[model samples]
Target chain A: MSLRERYGGMTRAEQGVSLFVCGFTALLVVALLTGGLTPSYTLYLAGLTGMYVLLSLGLNAQWGYTGLINFSVAAFFGLGAYGAALVTASNSPLAIPGGVLVGLVLAVVGSAVVATAIAIPTLRLRADYLAIASLGLAEVVRQIVLNQRDWTNGSGGLRGIPDVFAGWPVLGPLPGELPGLQFAEYAVGIPGLFRIRVLGFTLGEPFWTDLLNFVAVVVFVAAVYLLLRRVHRSPWGRVLRTIRSDEELASALGKDTYAFKLQSFVLGSVVMALGGVFYAYLVAYVDPGDLEPINTFYVWIAVILGGSGSNRGAMFGGFVVVAIREGTRFASDILPARLPVDVPVLVDVYGAIVSDFGSTRLLIVGLLIVLVMRLRPEGVLPPQRELLWPSALEETDE
Target chain B: MALLELLANGLVFSSIIVLASIGLSLVYSIADFANFAHGDTMAVGAYAALLAFGVIGGVGPTVLALPVGFFLSLAVGGAVAALVAVITHVLVYEPLEVDSIGLLITSIGVAFVYRAIIQLRFGSNPVEFGIPLQRPIDALVPLGIRITVHEIAIVASAAILVVGLHLLLQYTDLGRKMRATADNPSLARVAGIRTRRIEWWTWIIGAGLAGVGGGFLGLYNQLSPRMGFDILLVVFAAVILGGIGSVYGAMAGGLLIGVINQLMPAISNVAVALPLVPNVGPAYADTVAFLIMVAVLLVRPSGIAGGETT
Candidate 1:
């Protein structure tokens, strides 16, 4: 009962067409989000969404594809960020100069190490136990980072993470003649377009760090999306799906379910670590506060809400979460201006209340999670099960 | 002896854990899912007690009516906590049904909502019963050992609650029905046992104890929105160690963990006292429950008191 067993997977031509449409739509959304409403802030949000897209994609690989109840997203992400920090930050304990590429490698390696160590023993546990174990381990990871004062600087948080692209020869010089803040370059050529202003808006480009980091993120996200789509459609994806649907059946068929589960877990963690590295590089800072357990839950929410098994769905969920979380910051501007004849006293109270509407946003997110799971448990973008080979069902129906 | 001090401290914490873990285990056994929000139930209890005290504290005569007022606040706290816990199960969890993963995730949502509500209401700072607190009961003892009145009170109350629960489970017909439902719900239902009613009672008792535990815990530790979360993790450690479903196992396991949380840190502090070892700091001690939970789970995933494993 495979989609491949019915209709062969989407043809290359079909895939090409769909990819173009998705890309075009993504571009339009990016434009809408980045223009007029709060360009710099919107850019920051976009960069963050890209980072989370990677995280959710990683979670999708583990939970949606393999049915492993891995709750180590925050741990792996923190490790990645700290891993990057160790190599790249000015006061880092390590000797490595902050070459962005080297930091990424360290993050991926560090995440893999922790993932392997945690998975070796706990992978044998039932799903609920695994959840507990992973969650506990994540706390252990956070505690270790905090308590190991000599190593992690006692939670003051590492600073001065070198910008990965600011020093590049050609593109680095593009933001030339800037003073004080080295990264914020002035507008050029495009006049009003480049020099556009909004609340707290700066012209020309986002922090060169954000620009380069986001570019790098886009590249990574594109590569990962393409790669996941390929793997998800391949025979390997079939095996993972088999394990997800029925581990015993997969094991019975000699799929080595344990090994596969571990692989899926490590794979997901590695991707998440890469996200961590990107996040650290984009922000140019690392802190234990950035790696709370709540952040991991956010990634899981994104994956489940978007579409658990679908890479594109994961990205969509990432967008929705970031918009809800970050979009609220600019609500006063966008929301207040649009309101008709607001009561003066109530409006003042509303303004005061909306100043700290963070919990309000999360409440909505949480309510949406309950509602979505209750109504559309499969998510907004459920995974399509098209087959690689022409399916027998399709042929018979034809 | 320092050992006695640690033992007192251990017993106090263990009793609280005992109070909390029994409910956690009960839910895990009969309902068949790790109730992630169980810890929040404890927080709700403590905060509810705090609220009740705030309302009732001013009305009572200071000398004659304070104790009565305190007990009333405690009851109010426990009841409110239990009510909220039941509401969570009904509104959030029961809707998810047998989709355990979905229920689990939804519980995480519920935890966030609970924590956010507490934060919004109480703010981020820790709150306590501002009344001048008592010194250790062993304060007057000549052995140079100290155990606070709060500690003694916590331990005594825990013991009473444990005994009361034991008696209820062992001597009562409802207890038999609960045990039967927990053991085999389908079979109990076929035998004309009201399994759903038993489940309601199970949640009620579990949440009520959790609330009571929280109320008492706030007396010992300063109450905060995060108090339940930290305690809940440790309670989970105890529950898993005791074997998930077994009530007796959870009690013993809580005592074991409570001791380890306190006594082991005391031992480590002593070690640090000896000149050779450097100071690892108190935060290092927090990892014990997590380590023990993982290590115990590795050796005996079914726990020391084997619970249902499916």
Candidate 2:
């Protein structure tokens, strides 16, 4: 059977595998919780992973699905985070919700405007130039943001922003106490058995912010996944795929490729911006340093790892990639202090030799990308469809 | 006097930029890929020069160090560039069969690898040349224009290199081969030209020039791991503005950008003097080159000289 046919035939098995994976993941989480893992650290990692996944999905929408090369995803994300920070930092209550809404709106509008403006002059240029131009534009945005002290507070950064769910209690169900879910008081039975207090209202600590952020991310991802999946199966999606496969053919058929690309750019940018806004709320601070070009590549790695064109793949990619990064740090922290002398020396020497290795994660990431492109270009979770999608669709086509 | 000083400073800066950009433009034009590691190659040159100076020892050692530094830098840069070109071609570009966009992304990865290695060795700190030059020229020149001997040497070397490159490209058989390879690699190959050899030569020449530029820059402004990366954007802007693939254009673009960047802030008061608008001072001049680049890009996507799109 053909590869496509084989893949299609495995749908039921794939579902079962996914179920098993989910179960296994839950079991692992439970084990960690019971095994005395730092709750705050775990929560923080979960929130970060969720954010990365959101970003990866956004990028996948543009790059994998639409075949649009977006080198400025991080810039959009940064813009949203900064926008959220600016709004939340304001004393006005209207600014809080308004800030998030405004952040998302501006991110979409601004990215669209920039994309449109650039496309007019550069769309005809070779694709590579477009990539360069986009990269340059991202840098320009970063510099502008950095230079605009009056608005962005410059590089010193904006701090002490009000959290979206600040007044909410930690380790509790939503604001209202739900019936049939009693707060379990902490009790130790056998080594593995433990009960924790939940329900009602216990503020506990600031950890609730992270939990809320994770929930927010999950909801957002679900909504986007459903929306994108629908679009991917639509007639417009077919046209987008055609455009990706052959732009000239798409344009020959009277489709305006420029308009389609602009739409995709705007939509992907908006999603990234939303992720940024959520990230700001999670961190409670926004800084220029947080929005480096490296962040864009990180998202790229996630998308590529998961499966570029697949929404599910993007989510998986983001989670796995973030987990690896955060898990490495945790490993470093928790690893045994005393090893064989020779081994310790080797580790120390290697660490010193690759002192910039941490920052050089991009290099590692690049190598991984190269390896993926070579060995498994389809990625770990290949998209269901063979055809690539165009970034834009005519309103009539839709 | 201050105006003259600024002009002189701008000229010196422009010379350095031109030296750096021309090599970048050549590599991009010929290889059809942006060597993201180009900046690090420059850093390598600076470090090589430092090593040479350290080995030679004494006041006169710097004078002797220039050629040794330049040649060593050229060798190192060429070797690294060629190795990376081959590796990238095999690992990244060939597999994807994607266009230069994919290659460029891969180049970013390669650049980081080179940067990490450099940082591993150099510890990311700035290193000074610390060569004390005689002040006869500085004292003799009017307008408080203090052009050190090192600066003079840099200017002289840059002029020589530019002229030499122009001649080689215009008059040499190798230059013709490179041009042919750049214009149509398949056609060149069909004509029995060894495209791979031409590419190797192109990388060697281009990277060598970058190395020299880096070494000179190290002399002028402290040698740091980031120095090359920081200046890379400006160099790229110069390359694009001048028109990609045009060496002369790159040089001209570099000098024009450098001068405009310096002169704009000086003339900021002119805008204020003309109308009701208040003067924006020199603080924003740092962004002048980038603004010009953006404006130029908007106006002419193919660039000022109108060669390649990027």
Candidate 3:
């Protein structure tokens, strides 16, 4: 059946849920643009969340769509960030052409390379073994990044990397070369109007960068969403579902399940790499500490919370998770300072508590995952189809 | 003389590792999940021992602290284990009953929660207790490796615990029940064994042993929040090497890992002439353990004792 025909057959409830999701997303974007809820401090937080959403979607593509549990998303993301940072840095060979293109290529290629290296020995192993191996590999990658001071600058981290949109053309040339006209003079021309007249185009530096990043991220996400949607509706997607449902049966049907799984893994890893590039540009820094195992688990939580097999759900999950994290930070700021001691001791104690809470966000996230798993196994927005049951008993019963 | 001293010191270090690994192995075998919090359980035990030492003020408080620490840690560990079991069952394992993989991930979460709480309480700094033994050894025996009384105690205590555990598992009714449950949970349940209760007890005992190990380690090294994770690799390596379900294997494996960890540095130092091999020195012992784990897994995925479903 054609994609439209198949979608048309979906229940009204599903359609309603999709519509609500779209509405919520639109509302969030509008709020962000209009400065409704998020303030200056939280703008960075929102951007970070957007980056995570992108990463989570990549994970969902693998785990949610293909039933391949990747415990190394953080590593791939870090690699991408590092890749972009290294390439775009003033010292690197591929510093020109905006670094975005270079970063993208490097991330994709690097992810594929790492995936292939890991999959050769591990892909044939059992699921549990794969999990352990992937976790170990991630650690290995992290340690390598930490120890390789020459390449990654070791644990000291890579700083002073140029912003992706730093040197981009924000405004066009000025109309008629207004001689001796300062920026202040142009500023006073309009009240409540923040614009610079340059080459017939009026825009601010911050505005332009923000606009560029937003558009770039949206386009990337949209393209991925479309591609995933197409794949989900295709025969290839059906095969993937079959493999996830019953690997033996799919293999019996002459489907190279291992190859398909590897492809999914590599593809997802590549997408995560791109997310990492965005993250690097957003933060303007890349550090080994930023890419911890907990980060990968956070993405897992996001994808699962959103609805594993649903691309849109993964995106939504990312947004919610990031929002909650930022919201917690904002909440912490508003909280009354309650200390049991006085002066220096009080400051020390309060600071310790605050930092402890900050670090323990992962612990809370873990607890949330547990709650979500127990309460909603199918996730917030489960896949449209009932995927394969692993056992023969389940198959016959169904 | 210095070399002899280093060897003695290494042996002492190995003994502590062996104790820690044995406890971890028992838990892995019986509990069927790697308790990432196993290390913290050790830290908790060490702190408990420190508390005991503080309470019983005397010249020989360190020596006396052992039993107090052991018993206190046992109590604390057992209680915590039982609590974790119930919480895990309710929150993580129950929901994804069919998915063992999900349970594994949940265990990781549970481990993180335990770790965070510990970090929150302890503040990530290393807590040290003053050593009671001043003179490491007497001059009576010639060519003897001078060792601290505390180190001596650690070795002696580890031996006693290992033997005690071996005897307990082999001889007692509770031990037999535990074995039955570990062997076949469903079958044991059908055969009138309270498998859940058995599992609870297993956690308690396992965690308690870890606590005891931790207490001893506290005496040997410093107690930090990351101490558990730091030693986790070595412990797991030992467990896997010894055999997943076999207590004896764990003990042997622990001892073996301990020896390798201690000796590798000496060997590396001696090979300073080798251009390619930089002397890893004492600082990178954890790195050595990590490498060993990778090697073991690559060489033998079934582990030394083989996989125990329980």
Estimated TM-score for each candidate: 0.87, 0.83, 0.80
lDDT-best of 1 and 2: 1
- Candidate 3 stretches with Cα past 4 Å from truth are A1-43, A90-98, A166-203, A339-355, A385-398, B1-24, B34-37, B40-98, B130-147, B264-288, B306-310
* lDDT tens readout by residue for model 3, B1-310: 3567667777777776776776666556556655555665666565655665556524332353344444454345434544554555555554575365666666666666666666766667788766544465666236666776667777877788778887888899888888887777788889999977776677667766776677667767887766766676677767767766777777777877787777766767776868888656565565566566655667776666565432
* True interface contacts retained by model 1: 0.43
Fnat value of model 2: 0.33
Clashing pairs in 3: A172-A198, A172-A199, A173-A198, A173-A199, A174-A199, A245-A388, B243-B305
- Clashing residue pairs in candidate 1 are A3-A387, A4-A387, A5-A391, A6-A391, A9-A387, B136-B147, B136-B148
Residue A301, model 2, lDDT: 75
Specify the poorest-scoring 10-residue window by lDDT in model 1 chain A. A179-188
- State in Å the error of residue B30, model 2: 2.7
Please provide, for model 2 over A9-87, each residue's C-alpha lDDT reduced to its tens digit, 9 standing for 90 to 100. 5665355546645774685576454543545566666777778877887787778766777777778888778767777
lDDT of 3 at B67: 43
Residues A1-398, model 1: lDDT tens digits:
59554234564433643565477457646454445444445557778888899999899889988888877799999999998888878887655775777788888988998899999999988899899889889988998898786787758878898666767776566544343242343333465555542233344545544565667789999999778777877888889999988889999998888898898899999989988888887777888887778788889889988777878778887877776676666564466532256787766545543555665565666677677777778887777643343375467657
Give residue A3's error in model 3 in angstroms: 21
On a 0 to 100 scale, what is the lDDT of residue B297 in model 2?
67
Residue A248 lDDT in candidate 1: 91
Candidate 3 has a DockQ of 0.40
Comparing 1 and 2 on TM-score, the stronger one: 1
**Recovery fraction of native interface contacts for candidate 3:** 0.33
Which candidate's TM-score is highest?
1
